[model samples]
Target: MLAPERKANDDFVYHSGLKFALLPAYYLPVWFQAIKGDSAVESGIHILPFILALVVATVLTGVLISCIGYYTPFLILGICLAAVGSGLLTTLGVKTSAGKWVGYQLLYGFGLGACFQTPNMAAQTVLPRNEVSIGASLMLFGQTLFGAILVSIDQNVLDGQLANRLAGIADITPQQIENAGVTGILAMIPSEYHEAALEAYNASLRVCFQVAVVVACLALLGGLGMEWRSVKETHTPDDESATEEGREGGEKDGKVDDGKEEV
Candidate 1:
């Protein structure tokens, strides 16, 4: 739905729909894991760290994307840590081990808030000021491509695992399993398959995390491409200006970049 409007619209309805659809999958698992682990805030004071991280990430991305030559190791570091932490949070949430819920939520939440807006911001900054609408559409086209792919891949992997697990249990028909509630499925499962069913679910979830990590890793690696492009754009403009000025400076007998043009 979002792919066609690469030129004129940028509402990102498809992208936003994809985001919200996956939010429940991401949020509930983390929320439950946190609650299960009994990690309560000692006080409201503990929430400040997440807030700070979120603010810093937004500010840093704004600087790096909106301002030229703002490249530094900190941007790379923040992106890596935040992406990996977000991946692990998905794993931890669904796996449901006893751990600090609030702490984990803050870690993952801040990581998400920090990086989620960066790409759109980059797309926005890349556009000329006059083409805001077209630029927005382009941004959403890109966003939709990635977002749709992510949700599709995750859903496919999960659903495939569920189906495969059901198939292995000869006693339970596919229709039977589908018809059954979580309770009914558990109750109807042959004892021999119970452990395997459980394992399949956990494995499916782990696979989902693996897929998400791969996405983040791809983006992280792709940052280099953005960096190269930025540097090239910055230098190209400077070079063009310098050449024009030097030509106007009467060529100085091939004295290029010798500040003769500066005066």
Candidate 2:
């Protein structure tokens, strides 16, 4: 049985696709990364957690990246925790890790889910009270803009791949096309059609796939830059001020403070 945490993370990642049906093109692979364990397995079924995590991670990610504004720090921290969860799993050995990976995945998602919006919230908190509306506008704008850019990039990459694949098998038979899924579709073509189809498909799709890989690589780069600040780490004056103001006023006050000052 999967841990509650794993279930949560998987769901979270999957929900990210609510933005669109095809969004999986980008996020589905995140799941695979965890199971690959640096490609530890030669072949066959890797951990099922990857798929679940992919669903949860992507879903929460959309919320975090799109909805949350200034809370980027907290989100960063949450990701760290998630990594720890995965790390703990890895450390646990295969069976144990497999079992615990769920906790790691869920806690990571739940912990971060609350914080997904923290960045924007933080940004708004940090800004002057009068600037709150402006801050929000900007935050939402950035999210929408990035969404547009990435969506376009994703479509182009996919279109190129499809076009190439179709062209490669210019003489593609009904049988070959029927068997095609994503990866296996091309491989299934009969030997007679394989060469031309591969040439055309590979030629066309390679660039798009390459670009898709590049974009994925860039996303990974963002993860590389993540360094979660621990509780012991000193916060900026803005965060301190936000806290002080929150204490003075209370929870609502904290929200007010977050809106008026920095978090």
Candidate 3:
């Protein structure tokens, strides 16, 4: 059986991964729409590279883990990549090119996707067969809970940063910006201040990404704490029980055949 501490570490890593992965995923569309002047549909379209990369990486990670029978290395590598990607994301600006943003998104997406499922795999590998459901539930809870909390925190960071940076503009108050919402904030500002507002907004986004970088880096602790165990070395309780039952049935049949022969 895997130690409880290791399982806890897996949960921490899973939670951290969700934060770093989701913070950018949630906000990038806003950035595209607000700063890049893309429509909602266009922003969605622009992020397709990120979505595709995540999907491919997720599937590839699962396949590789199954084939390699180990998950710890992926966990470590994924977190490192995520940290690097998050750092790169902080460089985004109003003038960032499509190619640069797309590349950064792909890097972040793959990094997040690579280790996204491994924590659950780790839980299953470490927990008892019957307790797998509980372990999975815990992961799910952490994902949902942390995702919501971190998004709220990022929103606050964005709001506060916007207020602070845009305070120089005499026409717009923090209250007005708060009410305008990110999508509509620029429209509320005078055309002359639009450039400054975009800069402030972009800087605020950078701050959010900076938070993601820290969160991703903290995940390394959890990754290091995870026990290095092979999935192939472990059997579920049901599998063991089935094997035992099959062996007993074979023994019983063999005894009956011997009795028939003696008779």
Clash number for every model? 1, 33, 0
Best by lDDT: 3
Candidate 3, residues 113-229, lDDT tens digits: the string is 888888888878866676778788888877888887898888889888888888886456768877887578878778898898889889988999888888777778778888777
* TM-scores, all models, native as reference: 0.55, 0.37, 0.85
lDDT for position 151 in model 2: 66
Model 3: which residue pairs collide?
Answer: none
* Tens-digit lDDT string for candidate 1 (1-263): 12222312322332232233233235334233222322334323344445565676667665665556343233344456555565665565334543453555455445555455644443343333344466566556766676667667666675676667767765566566547633355567677876666665555556666665555555554443332234224333334555677687666554456645334
lDDT of 1: 0.49
- In order of TM-score, best first, we have 3, 1, 2
Candidate 1 clashes between residue pairs 3 or more apart in a chain or in different chains: 34-101
Ranking by lDDT: 3, 1, 2
Worst 10 residues of 3 by lDDT: 254-263
lDDT of 2 by residue, 187-220 (tens): 5557686555544543433343344333332332
